[model samples]
Target: MHLNRFDDLAADVSRGLARRTSRRSFTSKVGVWLFGAVAAPLLLPVARGRAEDRYAGEEGDPRSCDYWRYCATNGYLCECCGGSANECPPGTTMSALSWIGTCRNPADGKNYLISYNDCCGTAQCNRCSCSRHESETPVYRAGTANDIHWCSANESTAINCTVAVVLGAAEDEV
Candidate 1:
């Protein structure tokens, strides 16, 4: 019986593979692959928490720039740049000075004081870029103006992203 060139090549490859690897080694490799496939899903929740879970009592997505705390935010969102809305990303520093904004919470019908702090020491995050001009003051008013570079005061002038942190509930204006 004559075998085709394809069959002969396949037989030669299989013989070479069998000569190099034992049955036990092949079984162990297959076992490892199966174990990895089975274990991947179990590790997902530990890696990334659900978005709604992260913002338990908040009204909107923390990753979005339209969140209630970001009424006057004017940069990339930290939540979308590997950090939470109130935290800076790894390797970045939060600005010492922050522009304050009073945003009303749609869920509670009360105003909250939001501190717009910029994360510096890295290039711009370029993700989830958002700018809301609501109640922004003129550029001359540095404390309330969102146009100023908050990262300029940091050791690194590179603006990475912005975090909208809730300082407290705003007092009612008399």
Candidate 2:
């Protein structure tokens, strides 16, 4: 009796699976394909517009750390040193690690979160030490603090943080 009950259960499950597989009719498949084809083109422009909106910035002197892009900047400006706003100096390397800061872009009137990674393997760029702190804390709170030297993790010697370069930007969380 138990064996017969098990066989009946197996047959019921097999029938259920067969029904599920057969439910996707030809009309349903065509409807789904048609919906995707019609919606993709209409959605693409909106997606592109949102991406463009996140990258808005104001025209300002890059040499000054208080430039529109450097709203929450915490270290020396790379432009003041031998490097541009987004690049490290000739000999120095841009560190993979970085700190996050939220800077308001005057162009779009939106706050953008930027990654400020230090350029390692060079002397500290002592020129423009712009300590514009937004969410930054003291070195005791190393996770959020940009004042602490970040190059020590990448460089062998105890080199301090040199130029701070804008690695990337995105929309602010809040």
The best candidate in terms of TM-score: 1
My TM-score estimates for the predictions, one after another, are 0.67, 0.56
| TM-score, cand. 2 vs. native | 0.56
* lDDT of candidate 2 at residue 102, scale 0 to 100: 65
On residues 1-174, what C-alpha lDDT tens digit does candidate 1 reach at each position?
Answer: 245743453344333333222223333233334333544354335323422545656665676554678788888889888888999999999999999888888778888888999999998988777676666798888777998987888778999999999998889731
Clashing pairs in 2: none
lDDT of each: 0.71, 0.55
**Cα lDDT of model 2 by residue, 1-174, tens digit:** 377754453345333223222223233233323333544454335323433222235444565443556655566677667877777877787777777766666666666666777777767667665555666667777655776666767844333234444444555454
| Candidate 2 regions with alpha-carbon error over 4 angstroms | 1-57, 138-143, 156-173
lDDT of 2 at 161: 35
